[model samples]
Target: MVLQMSSNQANPNTYMGSVVASNDVVIQVNDLHKCYQSYPKPIHRLWQSFMPKRRFYQEFWALKGIDLTVHKGETVGIVGKNGSGKSTLLQVIAGILQPTKGSFTTKGRISALLELGAGFNPEFTGMENARLNASIMGLTREEFHDKLPDIVEFCGLGDFLHRPVKTYSSGMYVRLAFAVAINMNPDILIVDEALAVGDVRFQRQCFRRIEQLKEQGVSILFVTHSTESVIKYCDRAIMLDDGELKLTGSPKEVVQAYLELMFGSEKDTDALVKVDVENYKVEFDPSIDNCPKQASYNSGEHRWGDSRAKICYYEIFQNGAASNGLMQRGDQLVIRMWSLFEQDVDNLIYGITVKTNDGNAIYGTNSRALEVETPAQRAGDLVVVEFRLKLNLLAGDYFISLGVAQDHDVKDNIAIDRRYDLIHVHIRETLDAFGIADLEGDLSITLED
Candidate 1:
């Protein structure tokens, strides 16, 4: 069932209502549904028009019973698989497409980046297109002229602004269009995967500008398939499945739900169990498996995947004993994790990554990289994995992320379980280091004389 509860009210797991009440609400959508009539041939459309009352075209609902609300300064990320009405919803909100049923409302001016060169004419120069696009977004002639300098500088188009848009590449076109849309001083910004066309640096610049707009109280509706960006920038996220709102909540939870839906098999019925390392019977060598701390069962500390397997506990050992959050530079460390299998997993890959506290990835390696062979695991089986990593890092706090997935690095490989920020390690500086890692530079500055 579709829940239409207000954002200001208690957001229960599921409920039903007609309106989302909020004093600061900038966008409200209630029981929104969009349908498109598809005809098999051109003659069918004409015949339907002549019949008047008879139906000839098939009805397709791209959006089904969508209820959402956004307030001032809120950035909502929309995600789903392809053909799930992401683009249709954005088009409806941008006034480019009208709903066949239900309704929606938007307060304040909205500038959208839905189509590439949407409001620009190919015959017109970049300068002319900028003026035309700004004017279409409700900017007056005086306002357009006043913002022209800023737009040109933001686009980094220099003298190319005088050239006709038909001669420009896709990146150049998006740059100009994005610059114009943002410099219009809009109260709401709607992006629909248009930023994916630009290069990395341009995308970064766009996101930075979006952050600035967010700070200035501009409501944003963003649609993208990138989960990392959704987690990093969105305050709230909603997932759509087959034209239905499947989940809506914090970014991490929503993204996790989406990932599980895409990769997970049938749900398992076994309850989670934590076994103490010292007490549990050893199936393997006790010397290699024993660690100081007890096994932890905190599933809340990380995001998980399908229930085929799970990481029950993890710890880091320095030298021979378990280390408690402290490690020195160049210390030999062993990272170990215990996995509990709920379903048969033929092949598995163990992966580890080290990142800065701010989530910048410093180093990453997988079992595949080391050519390590893992035995096939069966249901009810427990496996222990230990990785030897050099502590050749600069003095700073870092996080470790772990994951177990299918035995491949391609897109088809499914993650059996994954955890972010699963372990935190702090390193005390013993020598001068400037970057995230100490490259171990060799000083051989001998005198030429």
Candidate 2:
């Protein structure tokens, strides 16, 4: 399912421009085209038999006239719905699938965690497959022997690493595949949602390893559906649709545009939603036009979206001071949400989550998380929700996300009001000091002498 949410938020229009403002090119993709010959229909197939086999051939272009470039050390993301030719592009990049026309170039050793069981033989034992998997990734028997222990440890497969490849669970298969790919020491690592194969713990492990690769200046091309992950990990992102590159920019902007296209038409979706987010401006007053200086906002970090809900209003307040995305350390951060109901909805809930600049959830609070609920509201009822919590974070960028739920907390309902108002905080907290909050810890020093 394409899980999407948009919330009422106060955000700036400057985000889309900030995405491509950088100058770098690590991966250059020229007029790349990959087309597969499709067979004709049954009647056409029979007719082609009477005529010639050539008559039944139809060209289905997967990658058509593509041009792009990746800067050195850039972590580029590839996002598109299923059957969007993402897999085909990666396969061509890995040289596993040949392009029908045009040419592309990569200046480094390549490693990929594409599809599971990509090179493994089902009949082979896990141990046998492990060796073969590493070899196919460009390692000799001796090098794999030296790195075997590390892969086993990272994968956490334990004895299962020695078991038959076919006997492993789907999760185990992914873990092994990831372990082998990362340990093979590739200069250009390509990951295609294979990281989602394992458990949360394993997923965390894979991300940490990806971090290591990035630090070492290894170029990465990741294809995933998780907008949050793309914003967190990718230096930049490229969005594709129908084998065509649509938007290229920072994760949030691309994700927002992609979501609007996937969920519905780019226009106002009041039918599927209730709150009219276009009229929802809460933090900065209408006079500011989303600027930080003129309004209560003191910082510039923020994100926004329409969680698919008719998100009406979202505001951030610190000690009664109105702000869009600025919060000081040791202050009480209060997020207020207001939405107009368009239906007799049951189990309607509002939630707010705070994340660091890199997209780490500092904390989250929802109406249902507190076991609170509002009586069923009418079509015109305006629902207001607020969350108050302590702001305790080291100085860095951060974002706020608002969500609307119909039944459960999951985005099963027509979550419309997913807004990403930019949140930039001047964290006055000192991190070297102990404790979760920025409050100075109790310390004592006594001279025995």
Candidate 3:
């Protein structure tokens, strides 16, 4: 069902830059700017209003010239560091805050789970608050009545739902708040990072409910610091840096860009070099022809680092033969990365992580972890780092990521270059397994008389 609410916001014809909204767009923002007037003293706020020419307040732009569009039934993740205006943008879209310059339009019944218990009154009972929240979310009287029982049951509060909200614990607060928000059947769900307060079980339940909502064609804008949630749930992601849009793309790629913005130095992401490894020869295992023969490294995959060094190419070798994507259980595998040092560096460390398709880490290793000492590197030098390990994994899809960092005394752990999901491999099912890894343990069943 397509539920829409009339938008009284600014005209859709106005734009901040070149952003144009399409017919399927549910939220359209053009040249959106939100600023707060900060005063040095409480009296200055009054003085600035009357002084006109004399400015007594400092302007802090929470959002600056932001233009974006969110299509229907899309779950977009918003990520940024603290003070990056992630919450501010969400509030603006949720209609809690008005724009300072530009205008935005939002369609549908928007229910926002922003700050914890934002719409609830402390003195009100949980039932009263739930009713109030449902009304605010545009639920009809009969609709809320029909869904109230389900909401109460999902919250698992029993008689506590009749108690005042002030007496509730933080976990209970989240349960009631989330229950009301989801049961109201909003067309657009806006969630901030408030779910972290709930316990693990409740958090998982909330994720499942959100997934259900997405399947029902509800648009969701989720703001979180959890990169795993973005990669696992969101179809698209946007990174905001100091109130500016830094990147917008697929979840994995955007998460990679966000990590680079946080951990590595800012550099051109398009800078790349090709590896010429044709001269190197390795004995082939002709029987293993099903393995992927090449790594899918392209501009679609996020890459970033300082220009001091770069990873030219990375490849996986199956049983001494170069392969990319196919593998079997208990097979000997070698991961080789060719790196070129563009500038002199004292010491370099190589790291690799084997992860599930959803970004869960199965195994990870680094030069520092393996007790291997890296020699000093000079400019115009090429180095090949290889990791050989038995593929003791179950039948599933997995990814390998590569990173190179410079070790220093004062400022250690500087990334020279890093690439996420550098290669993909699928472990062919050979044994009946259920979990992550094949421990290769013997099973014995004996019953005592």
Candidate 4:
């Protein structure tokens, strides 16, 4: 029962299709609730005996009223802060835990690589553990026979494969476990942060394998704190807050929502280590912006073109993706618009702006630069504009605001879209190893003594 639905029509809000169907649902979770019992404090229990407050126990709802459907061959990601119940949901899906209120139906074989050493035996040798774990995963000898070579090669643990698992390092064990899971040929692959355990090269190798599976249309339900990876890898994502699914959309939207939560408390920190609060600012990259020569507008009937549409909300993401303040520099970010038009006018104009914390304009672009003219627009039309470009910014936070105009005059100038406050990114030396960034350049330097 793989959720398999092909798109016959494009969703108005997204470039991707909304092909959801009941028959196509490979995985379904309805009213899923997982709760944990919490005993009252000893003093509270004593006081309850004397004067109870109706109930004496407490319940922690790990998941509340969760309803999600995953179609076959779709790569979906789960994102949230710690304690947001992402791990709990994945556990129920993998049959590791039972939901108190509801259950999920999943089709086909599911191979889960969650916590490291979850299914391994420390007493057994690596080779023995592999076979033992494979059997636990419901893999037959014939299947393991076919996949053993791949597992060995992926792990690069030739000599150690037969050594006692108890003697292996944590890294070695993780490599072996991940290799076996990938070779299982699962219909559903649940990968937690298992890839993070191995070295950088190994991590990249695993990502490449996952990427290939994505090309082959394997259904993946991945959970990670890394928003950048989610945005880059997952076609869509859902954001969770306090055991509830809060938002579902493109990765950029979900990650931004998570960061705003982090910043709320982090704003008061006196630390300057990760982000220099005083130096933080956000804006569009001017290098990638094209000042328009003219503008377009939307009419009242929500026509394809005209002016007078006002934006209600929007978001910008780099590399066309993001994580909780973990985006990289020189990433290509996209801008999305969700607008509502009130009245029709002769002209309509829109622009995107990126600025620094000190109020310096890093970049700005609008329809005016396209050298186009539009007819008068009527009222009641809706508009959604999309812009994408490579962002060549130093790692830091910045803010963006949308610009609105009519007849070459500011009608509602500098309208507040969504704010990207202190979008955080880690500038690593390894970024030079991949992507198309100039990065000023990378080379192995040697001292000529």
lDDT of all predictions, in order shown?
0.76, 0.66, 0.77, 0.62
What CA RMSD would you report for each candidate?
7.1, 9.9, 6.6, 16.3
Tens-place lDDT per residue, model 2, 321-394, is 87555556677887666666655566666777777655656677777668886577665556667788777765
Could you tell which candidate, 2 or 3, scores higher by lDDT?
3
**Clash pairs (backbone) in predicted model 1:** none
- Candidate 1 clashes: the total is 0
How well is each residue in 26-55 modelled by candidate 3, as lDDT tens digits? 788877889999899999988877888998
Q: Cα miss at 448, model 1 (Å)?
A: 20
Q: Which of the two candidates, 2 or 4, achieves a greater lDDT against the reference?
A: 2
Q: What's each prediction's TM-score?
A: 0.80, 0.72, 0.77, 0.57
Q: How close is candidate 1 to the true structure, as a TM-score?
A: 0.80
**Backbone clash numbers for all candidates listed:** 0, 47, 1, 38
- lDDT per residue as tens, model 1, 146-198: 99889988999899899999888889988987898888777778888888889
Winner on lDDT (1 vs 3): 3
Best by TM-score: 1
Q: What ranking of all candidate models by lDDT puts the best one first?
A: 3, 1, 2, 4
Worst 10 residues of 1 by lDDT: 1-10
